[model samples]
Target: MKKKDLLKLPSVSEVLLEINDNKYHNDKYIKYIIKDEIAAFRSQAKQGSLQLDRNQIIQSILLKITKLSTASIKPVINATGIILHTGLGRAPVGKKIISKVSKRLSGYVNLELNLETGKRGQRQEHISALISSITGAEDAMVVNNNAAAVLLSLNELAEGKDVIVSRGQLVEIGGSFRIPDMITKSGCKLVEVGTTNRTHISDYEKAISSNTGLILWVHTSNYIISGFTKQVKIDELVELGRKKRIPVMSDLGCGEILDLSNKGIPTNMIVHDVIKSGSSITTFSGDKLLGGPQCGIIAGKRSLIKRIKVNPIARTVRSDKWTISLLEETLRSLRMDSINDNLTLSLMVTTRKELEKRANKLLSVIPTKLRSNHNISIQETFVEAGSGTLPGATFDSIAFKISSKKYTPAKLSDKFRNAQNPVVGYIKGNNYYIDFKSIISSQEKLLLSSIVEVLG
Candidate 1:
């Protein structure tokens, strides 16, 4: 608070002189950082919360510069067993896929140039035929994400008209995006036709009118209503739409292509079946179950797809070259019956026995010093198929339960997270646990190194 104390603060030039690294030598940015640090120091000193020390202030400014220069989107190991974790970038594109795509995209290719005629081309042509072949639809297209696909479809087919949906199926996806809000934004009126727990086909029949533009059927992929539930099947709705001369649209939030029932994973209406069931248009996500880059796939009748393609909003929400190339490769892998090559599908179907073997291998590698210092053992845990793909289903998994005499569970978890290559884990019942279900075989060594570096 005294003039003399204010004079003790370091000058901006004094702080800049300490940043000798070439990367941090940008004088303008460094000066800004120094000024911001000085403002905070003045405020704290005024509140009697901090002392005005020149050396400490200079060191703090240097640290801020170092942090600012580092990359924020580096990779982290996912030890949390939740496959398709939204926080960890939903579905991870496989390294092999990335390499192949990189080779083609690193330089320019035929993105919008027609090789046959040497004329302009459409980007959607890259994935449209592939999606059609896999899903058995007349045509298909890709957008930036599922929400964009839904908005484009509604704006084209149901704008200034009634969009009928069941009350039970009105759901909210990640980031607080609700179905009703999307409908309103698309310039359509949302008409709720059934009860929350029970929706009869009669309710849909009564709700249909001349103003009905489209019949919307939403799959509650995130959650399930257990008892006393009744909703019309897609076939029945399709029949009704045929009679009423209206189009039926199905929003399968998670686009499942193959039947995973034999693998103990529950089966939803796959994309192929939805189109085969006579739905005019069916939309789903490419990132969730398809194990590809984030995008929205719209597959249905040729006429409807043609109309959707011409919409002005389609141009605004179209997928870039990277998404098209990556998704095209992913779908080709699926068509070739190479499921294991897809990382997301591989993690989802990894057996508990395999996980146990990995967990045991990890347990045997812990340094003897750490083994003596920390109490670590293998335990059984349960995790789900995250990102609203498979609801009410839990898969058995193996995890390493750890306890320390000097550190609490929360403290150990924090240490793991702050390691050079972060290992993300969870804490439960006074112990920190790292599940092996989500850890691919290649990441095992890095996981061990992180453990030794933290507990050693």
Candidate 2:
């Protein structure tokens, strides 16, 4: 084809005729491709440095065509059974809440307006009371993410002031976001105290000078210093702050407000109790253990919270309509007395017997040939309530281990990852470990089909 001829931005009808003449099967996609081609051609009307329009159009169309033909948002069997699988968008929102969001998104409602009086109402009011009721905090506010919450808090209180923190507590979470960097960005002077493994209250006390504005304690949620580790208690710091007339602020990273000391969670990890620890302000995430939308929630003395709210960055880092709506509903769920049954994390932490039933259903449906090719076994597996919530611990669960002759672990994983809905499972010891903790009963059939297609 000549340059100008190729540049003739094919119309829908012309494209259809060419495909028909060539006996191409995909006429349905030509309409969208032709539209993209035309848009590309017109946008390059300026004297171009390179032939940009002609080259990228076909490639863009082909990519879009592939995506359009493929299953876009189909559900996958979560045999990996990670309750809070961060990669899989964590907890699935209830159908009721999802429908509410759909209805709200379709048009505008009083997202910013109070329907009762026609006056401008606080957006946080949608969920604040519910969160307050559950946590017993005087006041609370939310931002886009936990990092933003920490940034906003540091900027508000300790800007250009010495913020005392434990050396071990200066953590680097996912994506290289370090605590010291956050403190620097917020204009706070870093005052590191004690050793990484052990820090006494006296170390914190010694660090406090007239410049000490806030004491920051960050949760080492992802790491554990098991042997010979001691740190000042949150309550102790709260007491110290009271005595010294200084404010203690801690970042309850991976914020779970539940009293998990007895719920089989690790020791002394309660957000509310820590909040009540005389800390003037407690900042945590709305996502993570909370199983809500990604948000940084700060709840504490109304006066300090008010200052943080008025800071200019609050407007910049505020939650959007969808996040606010989902978070509000999720907080409401937590406040209800009957919320235990509905909790997503709690549900994923089901016993092995629950998963065994689903596994047996899958086993019955799978073809005999594939089953014979692999040794299937149910072994005790542990699952993390991921999203950085529960670290160094796993819930007791069972998984289906399939080791095959025809396909290797990598090949099987690749097949599932590229399948219609994309299944993600772990491969350990040359076998695929499909944890029952993550899988639901309804997904058993699809899991069987996927296995059959890969190994059938």
Candidate 3:
């Protein structure tokens, strides 16, 4: 198009009239998209780079507007083998909750209404029984996340007092969230006891004073210290707390109900045992190893949990109806022994043989020319349960390695990520690898199509 012809371009009103009549793109935001496109085209036309005619411009503008309106957050395929990959929304929630929680999302729920008496009820009642059953706690409540659980617990129990925590246990997890920071934010004075390398029970004994309010025990689930490191056991901490008449709260970052080690996946605590250790209150993540929604669970003695529930901060950090609905069902699934059907545990505990089979299936489906262009082979890979769960624990996995003559590994990874639904993987040396540990069998065809689209 010529610069002179640019003046004759359709106005924003004209374009809106043309496309706004369509039912699908009739949203109010289409005007902004149209204006932006016109401005961009005007710039291109002035620069003598405009190649398309008016019809082509309208089509392109319509496509852009439609995409902008319809596509907001595109879901991605997880080939990274980080089971609880935080970047991809952490643990992938199962669709089983869709039908179960649909009504709660779209309509009114008895979230805090007691149907029997038609009176006010507790939202915590929804998952309290389930959590108590699974963790062997006298009572339970949930918040937005584990951090909130810790924050609320400390603010309620230890605010304006001292919280004695082991220096070794004052660790940071993903997103730079530190234990010390949370304690300080809760208005509790942090009494750091013992060395980072070695924190004995005596450290707590010495830290306890007249102002001591709570003994906080943190689980270093995200990272590990090697060689000679000693941290006080939860049971011992609980005993000390009992003697001192102070509560012991264990922040088991990622809580697990099942003993994954028996299933060949290494994990720190069997959640019930942590509660059984006699901690007055225990907090953990719902999304990490428990394979539930993104929420924080606090479970332990009924009295302590009741106090935490009534804390004012509890209202701010409480889970919504949808979360309760999903969490209730997730806990139910765990009790039903059908948890392997859930995505998180399935991926975490997938055997090497299973991944090898998936890799072979993918290998068989690659087109001949595409395989030739990219040096493709199956390789042994290591998959980690991510998001601070089971730190330093790796499971054997199978991956497809693609080293292309036409594209570098980084370039290939970028191309894959730029697809409609991003496919995430890692690059080592000159090859791009997609670990099969986290990829569901149902996603194999989509993964294959994405590779063909990007590389073929």
Compared with the true structure, what per-residue lDDT tens digits does model 3 show for residues 329-367?
878777434566467887777789988987887898899
Model 3's TM-score against the true structure: 0.92
Top candidate by lDDT: 1
lDDT of 2 by residue, 1-456 (tens): 245544644455644443333433365555766677566655554333225453355555555555665445667666676777767776655556667677877888677899999999888777767777667788888899989999999999989999999998999988799999999999999999999999999999999999998999888877877789899988999999999888888888877766554445554366677777767888887767776777889888889988998899999999988999888777756632344533464554456777677677777777776778877667788778776666787777888888877788898888888776567889988898888787755566677767776676
Of models 2 and 3, which has the larger TM-score?
A: 3
TM-score per candidate, chains pooled: 0.95, 0.85, 0.92
RMSD of 1: 1.9
Between candidates 1 and 2, the one scoring higher on lDDT is 1
Segments of candidate 2 deviating more than 4 angstroms: 1-64, 68-74, 260-268, 335-337, 340-343
lDDT of each: 0.89, 0.76, 0.86
Root-mean-square deviation (CA) per prediction: 1.9, 5.7, 2.8
